[model samples]
Target: MAILPICIYGQPVLHTLAEVVTEFDKELHRLIADMHETTVAAPGVGLAAPQIGIGKRIFVWNYADQDEAPAIGVAINPELWIIPPEPGQADPEHEAEGCLSFPGERFELRRSAAAKLRAQDADGKWFEISATGWFARIMQHEYDHLNGYIYVDRLTGYAHNEAMRIKRKRNWGKPGLSWTPGIDSLEG
Candidate 1:
């Protein structure tokens, strides 16, 4: 497995909706392996196919809670459902959210506290998973990428403006912005 270069926010590939994965063959498995390696190298909680310039409906995520071991898996052609928080449940601290594509940025984006996801594994076996808290956040973030949406797109008002300002300053929303893990400085 090789660590692939992550596409920055400006890449057109990222904005395009990813195609569904129909062939569960060796090529798909290899892509999943590379995605896992790239995600780990990015040191990110999750990554989508589009983030790595692959327009296939796939993603890899690794998230751990204080009480559990890390949950790592690949999701192909995933279908997600956002579950509303319990009555009186507090909202998530949106400021803590970050994306690998938008590297050095964080925004106050709202998302459900829990989610239900149905997806196929690398071998084409299907499974369902329920996630909450940070895991749910990661799921939503990666799912957005499959639909050609970014976390920043969910921001509003002042927060949205601030995110755009940051992008413009770094020329990230334009085409051809490049990134090299461990070498590029993403100082925001």
Candidate 2:
């Protein structure tokens, strides 16, 4: 397992709809392990295939509530269902989130409070999970990546403007930009 370089906002893979994972072979398992290693190294809650320049419907996530041990797993060909978020502007302080693709930037975006996800594991076995709070947020965030979206694309109000400003300042939103975790100063 190794820490893979994360694609930045401009990468084409990060903007394209990821393809489904069909072959559960050694290659698939190795990719999942590398993704898991990279997520832990980045110290992020999750990482998606597209973020690592792999256009497959796969992601790895690690989460732990204070009351429980860490839950870590790979989701292959995921299908997510989220409870619609309340209608209103997102709370800037409490709702802020960052993406590995965007790295080091956080912007507020309203998201569902609860979510139900159905996906297969690394071995192609199916399972389901219900998540809330930050776990749900992680699910939604990674899911968006598989669908060719960056979290910044969902920003609204002043946050949306701020995101655009940052995008322009960084000269992002094009292609071929990326950063290696541990080596790069940027973190998400």
Top TM-score model: 2
**Candidate 2 lDDT trough over 10 residues, lowest sum:** 62-71
Clashing pairs in model 2, backbone N/Cα/C closer than 3 A:
none
RMSD of each: 2.7, 2.0
Candidate 2 regions with alpha-carbon error over 4 angstroms = 66-70
**Can you tell me which runs of candidate 1 are displaced by over 4 Å?**
66-70, 84-95
Candidate 2 residue-wise lDDT, 38-95, digit = tens: 9988889899999999999998888766222238888899999987999988887889
For residue 84, model 1's alpha carbon misses the true position, in angstroms, by: 5.1
